[model samples]
Structure formats: C-alpha cells, structure tokens
Target chain A: MRYPVAPPTLADVAERAGVSRQTVSNAINNPDLLRADTLARVQEAIEELGYSPNRAARNLRTRSSHLIGLKFQPAQEGTANAAMDRFVHSLVETAGGAGYHILLFAVGEDEDHLRGYDDLLRATAVDAFIVTDTYLGNPQAAWLRQRRAPFVSFGRPWDDDAADHPWVDVDGAAGVDLATTHLLDRGHQRIAWIGWHKDSRIGEDRRSGWTRAMHGRNLSTTGLASRTEDTVSSGHDAAAVLLDEAQPSAFVCASDTLAMGVLHTLRDRGLTPGHDVSVIGFDDSQVAQVINPGLTSVRQPLEEVAVEIVRALEGLLSTPAVVSPGVLLTPTLAVRETG
Target chain B: MRYPVAPPTLADVAERAGVSRQTVSNAINNPDLLRADTLARVQEAIEELGYSPNRAARNLRTRSSHLIGLKFQPAQEGTANAAMDRFVHSLVETAGGAGYHILLFAVGEDEDHLRGYDDLLRATAVDAFIVTDTYLGNPQAAWLRQRRAPFVSFGRPWDDDAADHPWVDVDGAAGVDLATTHLLDRGHQRIAWIGWHKDSRIGEDRRSGWTRAMHGRNLSTTGLASRTEDTVSSGHDAAAVLLDEAQPSAFVCASDTLAMGVLHTLRDRGLTPGHDVSVIGFDDSQVAQVINPGLTSVRQPLEEVAVEIVRALEGLLSTPAVVSPGVLLTPTLAVRETG
Candidate 1:
C-alpha cells in the first residue's frame, strides 16, 4: 500500500507566502521576532502547506537530541528468555541516568545463523548503540568500526579482528570452572555437562572450562554425557538419554533454563536434586529464584554488565581506542539447595 | 566529560581544508563531480578533521530515515517480565519486514512521566513510534498528538482523550469472561480471581468481567475471593491465603506467571491442579508449557499484535486520523491439562 509523502518544505511554504526563506525560518523557529500580523500570515501559510521544520536544523541549534540506539538480534522464533528482559531494563535505566533515551533495532539471523549487521548500518537515528549476543567474526563490530559509531557489545567478540571495539561480557569460562570445580570438590565423580548452541562463543567457552576442570582431575569428556542445545525441552531429552546410559552425581548446565528441564526429568524418575542428584546452572535468572528448593546457579552480574557497557560507550566516545578491545567481567556461583 | 566530538558537517571540513563549502559537500556526497586532485585534497582534509556526513541533513534529502522508535515505561528495578521481551522481538521482526528499524526509548515513572517525551520529540531520526504499557491519563499520548508523530500502542489507552490514537491490545475483559465462564460450566461453585496491580486498566477490566459473569449467576463479589498483584510470589502468597480461608474449586489467574506460582503453592499443600482444583491463566506464555500438567491459559496473539501495530503505524502515516483512534485485537484461549 502507498503511504502519504511528507508535507512540503519550508522553501515551498516561503515561496507560497511571498517571503524570503530566512523570514519563514524565523517565523517557525523564532516566532517572537516577527510582528503579530506577520506571524499570523506565516502560520496560516504553513498550516495550508503542512510545512514541518527540518529536524536537523533544529537539532544543530539545540545540541540535545536525547536519543540513544540499542541494537539487538531477535531471539529465534518461539524462544523466549527472561534474562533478555532484564538486560533491556538495565540498558534503559543506564541510558536514562545520562538523560539519554534508547531505540531498539532487531537484526535478522543470516543463513549461517549470524546476525545481520548491514541493517544496523542503514539506520542512523540512534546516537550510540548497545549490542548483544556476539558471534565469531561478527560483522556488526567491523561495521561499527568503519562507521566510527559509538557502540558497546554485551558479550566479548570472538575474534582478534575486533581489536578496536569495546565490550562488556560475563566470564562464562570462569563460571563453568566454578561449577565444575564445586562438584569435584564435593567428592562427586562422573559429572555430565549440558550446554547451549555450540556456535555461541559463550557456550564454547563454558564447555571448554568444564572440559578443562574435568580433565584436570582425570575425568572423561566423551560418550553420552555431552549434549549441545539450549532449549529446555532439548535438555529434558538429553537428560533422559544421559541418565539411562550412566548416571552422574551432578549435572552442570549452561543456563538456568536447561537446569529446569533436567530438574523436571529427574522428578519424573523419582529423583530429588541436591540429594539423589546435584544440579548447577548459570545465569541466575528469575526461574532460579521461583523454582522449588531454589536453583544453585552461577549469577552473572547483568546489572554490572549493563553499567559497564554504558561506561565503555562513554570511554569510546572520549578516547576512541585503536588497540586491542574487549572486556570480560567475572561471574559468581550462587550455592542454593539444589547443589 | 569533555569527550572529543567528531565533526560531522561538510562545512567544518571545508573550513579546515580552506575550500568552498560546496566543494567539500560535493567531495563527500558526489565525489565524481570534483576533479581527482580536489577530491583527494578534500578527502585528506575530511580524514584530518574526522568529518562524516551529518545524518540529519541526509535524512532531510531522503525524506525517509530507516528508523522507527519503540517506547516503553521503565519497569521498577528487579521487576521485569518475559512477555515484554517477546513483545520486543515481535516489534523488531514486524518492523524489519517493512525495511524500517526500531529504536527503544523508555520513560521513567516519575510524577510527570511525560517529561521524558521531550527527548523523543527532539530526536528527528525515527520515522514512526510504537508505544506500549499505557496507563490512565497517559501524557505521552498527548505529547505525541501535539507533535504529530506517527505511533501505535500495544495496549488501549484508558482515557477517551486517546480515542484517536492507534493501538493493538489483548482483549483482557473477553479473556477473563472466557475463563470464568469455563469454570462455571465445569460445575465450579467456588471460583476465585487473581490479578495484577489494582490501578491498571487492564486488571480492572478483567476483574470487572469476572464480577459481571459471577454476578449474573447470583454469586457474591466480595465474599467469593480475589487478589490483586502481578508477581509470581504474590500469586503464591494469595493462593495460601485463599486456601486457608476457603478452598476454591478453581482459580483464574491474571497471567501464566501467577499460575506457575499458584501451582507451586498447591503442590506444597499436597494438592494437585486439574485433579484437586482446576486452574486457568492468562498469556499462554512459554512458562505455561514447561510447568507440570501444562497450564491452560488465554493465548494473546503476540505475533498478530506486532503485525497489527506495524500496520497501524503505516496507516497513521498515510491518513492522519483525528477521530476514532485505534483498534483492539481479541484474545484466544489455549486449553491444556490444568483446566
């Protein structure tokens, strides 16, 4: 369907009003400078022509647009996560503290399951961008660098090519190490690991930490103990298979969502967590607090991550770093009754 | 902070290059129009000055910027919902389909919440807006009208003054009626209702529908049982209170979150939902599927709502309406084991 075009320009209005372009601009911008009769005539002409002052001209004079842009990749269809909601809230609060606002833009997933960065480059309304869910060879970072757009990623970039971009990411490897080591310290052997999409850098790092911690103690990382997928239902199916082959005393999950599914599977088999089997999860999300017996998970400082993202944006705007870039924030393990 | 702001105007680069302003503009906007030597000189000067084309001026020439603004009321600290995240995803997808982008802006909960609207109005980047979480006497609606910005809301405006503003909202009252009538049809003599904040128009309308349906069958409104609060914890607490006084045969919750909590509370008290007492919930969210027995809930068409919001925005831009503001989409029920 066709949409109505924007109204005529100030030049058109001026030509119709039989006045100079400067006088028309003054009537719209500095109405007090014009006499009452002259102002009325100009206003009538503007109304007739539906003239809207160029926002660029006005902003150049005002210097306060108060708009910030937040760029995000939409979650896979039918995949909902509460942590994303918390992140959005945190970003909004941080932007508001600086008297800036946020506009959200969603980039689509490509054939390779990576986010579309070209979409972000085409949109130029936001003053700065806060990006999340980075992948290896993320084009968004490269494009942001070329455009010199002020931006900060919620997670660290996977490649060294992102040497000039700034980021704030949770220490996924450290969190996994904490969970894996905790189970080992508890005198539990044969621990299994369930993770998210293997392509995600965070997921790969967490898996690496788990493997390292396990191998450090001479444990095996082979067979049915490893499942790579993030969905709760997928976790349940994986747990069923893992439980049938060889039961582990503890299970380390990449996220609380996976933990919930595993917990349900254990319950179905008449097993209780923290007693019959220990379970540890990451991203101490809302589900962790609301679930029964609570969830023993690693709590990433999401609020702190958001705060640091804003700080990084400001830092980039001030200094414009040209060297190695990326920041890794630490995560803490929350020991609840589940583990 | 005294950040180094990059010069974005051609005039600034022209002054630095000691060349005419038109020459500099031509070098950037139309390099072919200038000689190779002059273009090289202008390009060198632009690099030295860190000059980029002013986005505002570019937008003025194109008459359409690729930006769409999405505005929401900032949630209270530590209080966020997964539904809001889904809503954001929907907006992003729908807007992206139309070759436009979204920018997220949040207004705080201060006494004059509308004060933040100035930030959005001053920013001339976005072509349209999508507003959500409307409340009674919304000042943002009024401000958008005064500025004549194109926008659509996720929920209907409470005040008749916003009757002219376009919106796409779930039929809360209809959903409540469906839930209540289903319970009544199932031979449930004692039925209770649980809702979110008392002040919200959506909550009030749902409660009103429940009361009307109950009263039609000579049921007592005050003595039956009701709790007004949004959180899952609140739902759990309300369930305990309701059970302690007089157990209802069925409970109708404001959202799936409350239903999850109610289910947990019932399990704690050695009661089984769908067996001991039936339960129904609103917003057949993702959580509904994971919860045991699956939650029977009112499915608000989130994707449809998103599509319609974009359509309304397009309509607003084409034919600026002065009367009969927005449209409200209906909610449907998804029957699962709980009811």
Candidate 2:
C-alpha cells in the first residue's frame, strides 16, 4: 500500500466511518451529541487515519480557544529582577499540561496597558487572561472585571481590598520578615531596610515586615529605612547612606537587584560581607545564585504559584465556573554566604 | 440612548445591514468576496455596532490564525545567559507591530522536540513557527522540513550545509574575533580561550574566532584553549587550570557566564580582573552590565535579528510568498571596564 501524500483530513475520517462530516465533527468536539455506536465508528476511523481536528473548527464548535492571553513587557535593562523569567516558564509548562497555550502580545510604552487586553477580548482571541500587573491602583483587574472577563492575576488587587478576583501572590511581608528574623537570630540588631519608594504598595508591604520585626524586639528603625527606585545604583546609594549615617550591621533589601547594590557598597568600603555586616535579598534570582558570594534571598514559590494560577483558570473555565478567593503563598529564605 | 448589556454579534450586524450572517462574515474575513456597495453597507453597520469579529470564525474563514508558534523552554538555572528574555521581548514587539502574536507552548524533557510543532500544525493553531534551536545535529529543522511546514529559525542550519531555510543569526565568529582583537590591541599575547565543548556547533564556531585571531598574529594557541560546559563554575575551573599551566595574560570566553567564573578565579588568586589579567565575554548580558567594574563583552543585535525574522515572515506570508536566504547580523563589542 502506498502512503498518502497528504495527511488525512476530517472528510477522510468521515468517509471511512460512513458518516456525515457533521457527525465526525460532533464526535471529536462534542461526543455527547453523538450516539455511542456512531462515536465509536468515528473514533476508530480517526485512529486509523491518524486524524487531528483543526483547532479553529474545534474552537467554533466548543466556543473555546484554550489560549490564555498574556501581555509581555520589555526587559528592564539594568534591573536584576528576573522573576518573570521563572514565572513565565512555570506558567507555560503548567498551562500547556492543561491543554492551554500562552498568547503573548506587546504594548507600546506610550499606549495604554489595557489596549492589548481590550483588543484580545474584542476579537475573542483567548479564553481568558493571566494578568501579572496587579500593582497599586492598576486598573487592569477592575477593567477586566467590569467587562466580565475571566482572568487569574499573579498579584493581589492592592488598590481594591474588596475586589474578589481569582489571584495568586507571594507574601512579600512574610518573606522579608523571614529574612529579618534570620538576621536577628544571628545576633544582629540595627537591621536596615532598603526598599522602593513609599508610594509603591508592594514596597511598603515589604518594608512593614522589617519594621514589625524590629519593633517586636524594641529596636528603633528611625533612620535605618531608605526608600528609593528599585535599581542597583539606588540600592548602592541607599546602603552607603545607611552605613554612614546609621551604621546598620545587617540589611534586608526588597529585591535581589537592591541586594547586589548593597554587596557593591560593602566591596567598595573594603568590608567583608557576612562578617562586618549581613545582607539578605528577596527573589532568589540567577544573579543571587551566581554572584561571587552566593546571596541569601527570599525565594518565592513561583512553581507553586503557577500551579495555583492554572488551577484557578481551570475552575473559572469549568461548566459551573468556580471563582476561588486569592491565594497567598509564603516565600522561604535561600541562605548562602551572606546570611 | 441606552447601553446594550451584550456586545454586538454577527447576526446583529447582518440584520442591521439587511444581509445574511454569511455576508457579514464574508465582509470581515474576506471583503474581496462581497460587492463593493454591499461590503460598504456591512462595514457601516459593523462600525456603528462596534462589532469585533470572532477570531475563531475569522480563522475558519481565512484559514489563518495570525499567530506564530514558539516553544518556550524552561529557563536554565544557574546560568547567566538571559538572551531569551531579550530575544522574546523583541520578537513579541516586532511581531505585534506586524499584526501577529506569539503562541508559546512548553515541551517535556522526555518528549521529542517536534511533538509540540506537530500538534500545533495538526491543529492549525498557528500560521507559522519561529525555530530557535539550531544546535548541531538537532532533528527539529529536518523534521519540520520533512513535514513541509512554514518556519524561520534564529540560528544557521549547521548540520546541513546545503539546507536552504529562512534564518537570522548573529555572526559568532565575527563577535569572538572582535573580542580577541581588542585584547590583542591592548598588548596581550597569551590570550586563553574558554568555550563550550566541541559538540556545540555555536561554541565551536566561537572558538574558531579565537584560534583564527591567534594564528593570524603567528602566536601559538597550543596550550591556551580549554573547553567545558557553559557555566560560571566551569569557567572558574578552566581559568584556574589555564593560569597554573599556560599562564595566559588575557582570556576570551564564549559567554558572560564563563567570563564571570574567570573573574571569581582571579579574585581568589589575588589578580584584579582588568589590571592584572584582561578578560572579555560574549552575550553582554545583564550580569555583565551590573557586575562590579562592568564587563567588556560582545553584544548581539537581538532586536535586529527579531526584525529580520519578522521581515522574513512577512515576505513568506505575502501574496505569492517570497522566500529569502539566510540573514547574518554582526555583533559589536560593548567596551566597559574589563578589557
């Protein structure tokens, strides 16, 4: 027997099964719509022909694309926050295993961030969205909610406390607390906190952890807090000022990027890290791992977060959709040479 | 004066335009199939109703998805190579401007690399693919070719010299030459080369640059070349062995990851990176940028590569499709503190 030059199509399977094209389509897309005997014949024919249904047609028949829309932002040039790399990897793997793919679109710096989401929604291009930007007062979650769009955010709705959206977020305060307490347990007081500006809700949350830990021990955090942009240079400058003014023996930074800056400041001053002072960073980034002295950092449970996000998506897309409350996971410290 | 709770559908547009649902579908998916006046009437109704055509229906009508499928691999842990972050960002932006989005899928370690491609093709989930894996003897390109799939790769087809496929790649040899020559110009004779093992086609190509540059100056590279895995620890070990055995005054690494290792080894041996021993690395990664004193390395024009790939795709998808030959872009040296 000669091999067919072209792969078998749905019509080929229908003809082999002695059924109409609609019967084969229903058998693949909505088996419940077909009788058991007809479905069995179609299945055998499909297997014999090695037929794979067209996704577009299947999407129309099922009213689902099994594609999740995600807006991919440009890489921040100087920041060492590679959290998205690991998170995206995990999300893709988790979603793929669940028969879903991530459809990524780019938005311009000048364009409104919601424009991409609106366009995708208008075209019905994806079944749902995986929103990553849940920053303070960010309108994406609320906007999607207003349009009754199904979504799962990687962060909590910081601006709207009453917003009941499906979300999965790492507990930043808990993570920073773990770091600060670790340093305190190592006999360090005057633990300085280096974080983002006060306007940043996430930064404030992380800073509160350090303050709470310090206050619990009756240590004044009056001049040990420095807030600035989340960058290596800012981190470096903050650490320098804190060292000169407050002379803190330990530092708990908001991110690994900031931690790298603290490391730089220590190196410049000829002070040995973890000896003269201790440093702990958040987000166990690749930089934290491969730096000269391994960085002690708060590693977010990103893999678990991805699994949770996919779980939420599945629940949202089910026939009787279930909208679960936000999931908040705690991060663990990855101790190394620094702390 | 009142707002409609539900969005407009195809049937609504057809009714407003006094046409059948098929006419409105044809107007959106294949305007060429409709009479000019009838198409204009349907367009007016659609604009008035603010109707966004369903992507699935459009796909079925046009036999296209306006999507490019890309397999996103898990991020390599412990490696400083963040090229994908930059490349993916660029590809998404470039493709988005051209009215196409990226559909990302994940593959299991034990599964064939082509399984994802085959599944996507069989399902007609994407219009084409952007292949990134062009490693030596990799079966992906050959398998895709055998299936007569439309694709553009990010690396040259190294295993098959006669293979003609649209690809955009950085000139690895040229990048290494630039790095080597910079060191040579700085009065470095014994320039050791630290690169990946011989099995990697890209690594071998990069090593050739060092060999060619050394031979061009009539300098013996007999004991100065060392090969290992592309990792910081491997680079450290190679640098240590080279310093003890050959005592090279300068070093050129295949990647920033390896170059970082050399810096660690130098620090361990009481040698300043740029002062006592010159060093250069490829892929001017974020690590190279933020590392102390900065790292002098080669920067691939990944944005340009993305643009070229999109250009090739546009040409391939145009009416009566045009296929272009491989495009090779040259990389430039990012002069910083190291070399």
| DockQ (Cα-based) for each candidate | 0.25, 0.38
lDDT of 2 by residue, B202-283 (tens): 9999999898898899989999999999989999999999999999999999999999899999989989889999989999
Give the DockQ-based CAPRI class for model 2.
Answer: acceptable
Clash-forming residue pairs, model 1: A102-B104, A103-B103, A103-B104, A104-B102, A104-B103, A104-B104, B163-B325, B164-B325
lDDT of 1 by residue, A232-325 (tens): 7777877888888877888998877788778878888989889988898887765566566677888888878878877776665444442324
Measured with C-alpha atoms, the lDDT of residue B164 in candidate 2 is 57
Q: How close is candidate 1 to the true structure, as a TM-score?
A: 0.78
Candidate 1 lDDT at B118 equals 49
lDDT of 1 by residue, B78-110 (tens): 222356666777877788787676766665556
Give lDDT tens digits, candidate 2, residues A1-339.
111123457899989999999999899879999989999999999876657777788888787889999988654877778888788889888998999999998888999889998888888888899998888889898888776678999988888888766899999999998999999999999899999998888899998889888888988999999999889999999999999999999999999899989999999999988888899999988788877878899999999999999999888888667787899999999999998
Worst-scoring 10-residue span by lDDT in model 1 chain B:
B73-82
Question: What TM-score would every model get versus the actual structure?
Answer: 0.78, 0.90
